[model samples]
Target chain A: MFLHLFIVNKSGGLIHHRSLSSKAPKLGTNEWLRIGSTFHSLYAIANEASPVKLPGNKKNGADDGIEEIQADGMTLNCFQTRTGLKFVITAEPNTTAAVDLGQILREIYMLYTDCCLKDPFYELEMPIRCELFTQGVENLIQKYSRIR
Target chain B: MSRTPVNILDRPLGGRGSRAETQVSLSAFSYLYSELVQYHQNRVDSISELERRLESSGYDVGLKILELITYRNREYKREIRLMNILHFVSTQVWKAVFGKPADSLERSVENTDEFMIIDYEPLTSTFCSVPADFGQLSADGYMSGIVAGVLDGAGFSARVTAHSVALEEGEANNNNTNTSSSSGGAQSGNNGSLLPPRKEKAVFLVKFSPEVLERDAAMDR
Candidate 1:
């Protein structure tokens, strides 16, 4: 089951947050902000910490960096786009639904494009609170729950 | 939790209204714009008329974009000078719509009232290719309309038109040579080199109203 979602911008600011399950622990807004920045730094660190120049491999060793994290019976999956926007989702351990999580993240990205980026009244790099966006996320959560 | 439902369009767009970092696929936008051009093409008798329709459509968008961008920039005191507005359009507006600033912004050497913004490969024309017989038909009319709309919305009152400029064979060859030299081995593997050269250049000409010049002179005094 999905527990919470966080969208961190390229500059490591928390642009969005949503909690799907009531059982999820609640953190103060300040704590959430700190976590978002920490995750951003960890992503960079993970990329740099990749083993240098594997023998016989022409491609960069860090081609695919820090994609998932497992801790305390929870799974944190991170998907980074080419433009550097990060989508992080927390789920129950042993879900084995990485593909599903990626699809959900992509769908959320599309919704953001349509509801926020394309919006004539929207500002760039601001917190996303569009009604359509909220509704779309909710719909996805409900759909995923039923399927599971 | 019963509450009066508000129309989505009426809601505020900025601040905490929605997430602003979303992006749409370029292919989707290209398809939609192609249909828009085709729709206008069927309804008009002449190229100019078709362009007019496109400009009008873009004009509406420009007005809305101007407000949105201005609000986002927090520029409560709107730009009043002609050059400032043009710069804003060429840089800020271009980035907002196309994800990059315009390639060049130049004042017309022959006409003092005229200015030009050039985009080497316009987004609207990325997927469009006009037939040989169709003289001077470029999909950049939409961009011209956008420029006009932004100018008009900002009280500059200008006329904007899009023109296609075919690159000379020598210049085209030079460009290709430069690219080949830089990439060398990568050129052979690139698929883009296989396609024929289409209309890859566009110039948006903006002519400000005479009153704007008069106002500028007064301001200078």
Candidate 2:
């Protein structure tokens, strides 16, 4: 089951956070911000430490970064866009639908492009509080829950 | 440790991959645009205000897309000429947004500063239906903003407006007669008959600032 969702900007700031299940632990806004920055640093460190190198390049790696992490009976999956915006989702440890999570992340990205990026009222790198975005996310969560 | 600032031009086009051609579902876009319109409609008191909001939104998209498309075309240098920029907007930018080039690009015979970019079916207004009371509300204001953005980004300040010109059979004949008497008689005569039946057509009217024309003259000299 899905537990939480977090969107981190390239600057390691939390742009969006949503808790899917009521059973998920409640964290203060500051705590969530800390998690976002921590994860971003970890991602950078992982990319730096990886042994595999890109086919044509010596410095960059083909490892698309740390996509999934399992810890404390929970799993965290991250999907990063070409622009460096990251979407991280937390799910139960035994939840095996990695592909579905990726699809969800992509849909979220599309919503962000349209509702947030395209909006004149929305400032760049600001927390996404657009009503349309929230509605789209809720719809996606409902659809996924119904399928399960 | 000192780090050199990353130059955007020095980086690869798609960051990691060679050239990533990304696509969003049309239905998804339509829904989002509809919501955007509805949101603006509720807040604004006037039709022009609603259009202005839509235009500003499109402007932001246009500014980002100008950089992106220019970057994507690795051989593209900065466009300086008026005609070249218009061609870029009607062809490259239109294709990037709507998956096809504009139907036609025409220069106004009566006005030297005016140009028209025709789209047989503009994506932004395809699903939109203006109510009878809405009074000449063209959903293509967003597209106009995009055109304006492209022009402004290329150093040509311009005012772009969208007009729905889907004339009925009888009205087309009347328009043809009226145009035949005007300065652009031959061009209008051909345009009226060339369009297919029953399809919505939008014309983006672009009027460049006077300084742009002066610059063009100086460049020609």
Candidate 3:
């Protein structure tokens, strides 16, 4: 049921975006950039606005940001790591099965650490255009997302 | 590819070494460190420049080490807060590299963005005796560089510097006397200590960028 995946760097830059399904939103390149930066700021703001402040040090689950956005057709699930990397997936609300997206997101993160981080050519905060990383993500998203 | 000669790059950078605790002897390390310093001295014109070179070298190692350790860690433990990252550097990072954690982790009294990790008898400089020309230079610049690399890798951009905080013998004695009785000093003096009194100290100062401070503040408000 997963439709789209987005990777936002710590600086709020849209480093990677993939439409996992035909049902995913179609947008201009600039729009994705806007979405990444917008989500970045909003994540921080949401934390500040929250009545119960999450501890800053360790893993703060659901964090200070919006974890899910259940719209009419799309349900957006966000997983933000302690290092400020955010993984977002938009799924069909009816078919995504109320599953824990965080587990899959963590898996994707491990892929990132191994494929992109281990690559000497890869620089932090730069656009992730690594082939191995792309392949790794594809393998993960395919495995985790329910067959439509 | 199998026919090609195997070198450092070809070998597996596996996590097995950490488990095996493959430690290098202090004497061997001293020899390597002196050679590294001498190599940098020949390449750089100024002491600061030499230090920067050392820092950059350490930075390379720091980046990989931080990522490796975090990746190896099984728990969901990742540092988000400023204190958390600093604590990781002083304790976890230091312990991994130096076989011991830093002596103390302290926040700057005046500047909120600044923090310090004091390491008494830093591993890299244990046998290093700097030339008079490079007076007051701390050989632990590489150590500070590693700290900087780790912070930057973890999304906290910062500048880290290593300084020598070792006091003169007379002053050190006087200070020790003020804190403890003279009779107590004699016992400590001949207590068969491994390290001599008035040993040099390497203080690593980490000054984070303003943006980090702002972001952290915004998290609260």
Which one wins on lDDT? 2
Q: What is the DockQ of each candidate?
A: 0.01, 0.02, 0.01
Error of 2 at B102 (Å): 0.4
* Poorest lDDT segment (10 consecutive residues) of candidate 3 chain B: B179-188
Which parts of model 3 have CA positions greater than 4 angstroms off? Answer: A1-148, B1-14, B17-20, B167-195
- Candidate 2, A20-116: lDDT as tens digits: 8885779988999999999989998888887775666445332447888888788888898877789999888766553378777877776676556
lDDT: the better of candidates 1 and 2: 2
lDDT of 3 at B121: 53
lDDT for each residue of candidate 3 in A47-139, tens digit (9 for 90 to 100): 667787667533344476888788998888888877788998888888556556666677777667545554433567888776556766776
Q: Please, what is the TM-score per model?
A: 0.50, 0.49, 0.49
In model 3, residue pairs whose N, Cα or C atoms come closer than 3 Å (at least 3 residues apart or on different chains), thus clashing, are none
Candidate 2, residue B202: the lDDT equals 86
For candidate 2, the TM-score is 0.49
Model 1 C-alpha lDDT per residue in residues B63-91, reported as the tens digit of each score: 98899888887888789898999999999
Better of 2 and 3 by lDDT: 2
As a whole number from 0 to 100, the lDDT of residue A56 in candidate 3 is 59
| lDDT tens digits, residue span B1-221, model 3 | 46877686666634466532344444445546666777788888888998999999999889988987777665457687888888888878876676566778998899888898986656666435454457777788888889999999989999999998865565433233222121122222232122223356778899999999888888888
| Deviation of model 2 at A40, angstroms | 54
Residues B65-100, candidate 2, lDDT per residue (tens digit)?
A: 899898877847999999999999999998777656
